[model samples]
Target: MIDSCRSKADFAALRRGRRFDSELLWMSFAADAGLARPRVAFALSRHAGTAVVRNRVRRRLRALFREHADDLAPGRYLVGTRGAASAVTYRRARAELARLLETAGAFPRIKRTPT
Candidate 1:
């Protein structure tokens, strides 16, 4: 399961982390050897939209993160939503996030076996 980054230190550390950006969102990642799973935090500025819009986007992003939690590397991720993110469909958002994570090498390669 993915954990939420709740501590001030965790958020602070993201400032020093490697960053990746896309039209929908920008992300920062910092590897942590002590982590058993990926931890994430979200940021949405007022420019994103009204409170309702921001919450909707946050919920969508959270669901997408949960679906990919197992694939993610052990790290802390800070995800900031762009205005476009508040307007996209869930499928498009998912696609963008997948591409972003892939570009960041956040998802490790898994071997497959033929049955």
Candidate 2:
């Protein structure tokens, strides 16, 4: 599945719905079993870094979502990077993102495969 997010209407739903925040990101989710499309908005403000740094942060965060989209709930999510995200590596970013999702209770606990 592709990580495609479009339209202001979808995002408006999340913002007006339930919300959660971590040091690394912000999440807005709602329980809609009726099926609303999944969407994401990333916020990398100028205060986060210079142009080059900001873009790099954006790329890394987008990649994390692209790779881990299945872990998220089907709703609008806005991942806003705080000032500290610029200093972290890609792997660290991934960990932070996972932690954020877990804290939000958005990630379902995965079953372990027995050898």
Candidate 3:
């Protein structure tokens, strides 16, 4: 199961971790020595939109993150949105998030055998 970063300390640590950005999102990641799966937190702010819009964007991102939790490396991750995120569609969010994960090199590498 995907873990949630529920403490301020954990969130602070993530803030100090490596950061990545895209047109739709901003993310931070750091290795979590104590976890076997990645933990994620959302930091959507009022700047993103009204309460309804922010929650919608947050939920979409969380869903995308959960779908790939197993594929992600064990770490503490935080995803936040800018003013533009609320304007994005689910498909765009999913595709952009996937690209962000790839840029972070967070997915495990697969070994191939010569055939």
Best by lDDT: 1
lDDT of model 3, residue 110: 40
- Candidates in descending lDDT order: 1, 3, 2
The sequence of per-residue lDDT tens digits that candidate 3 reaches over residues 55-96 is: 889889889988887778888888987566567789988887
In angstroms, the error of model 1 at 67 is 0.5
The lDDT of each candidate is 0.85, 0.69, 0.83
Q: Lowest summed-lDDT stretch of 10 residues in model 3?
A: 104-113
- Give the poorly placed runs of model 1, Cα more than 4 Å off: 112-115
lDDT value for model 1: 0.85
Output the worst ten-in-a-row residue range by lDDT, candidate 2: 29-38
Q: At residue 86, what lDDT does model 3 achieve?
A: 64
Tell me the lDDT of model 3 at 94: 88
Off by over 4 Å in 3: 109-115
| Residue 19 accuracy (lDDT) in model 1 | 92
TM-score, per-candidate, Cα-based: 0.89, 0.76, 0.87
lDDT of 3: 0.83
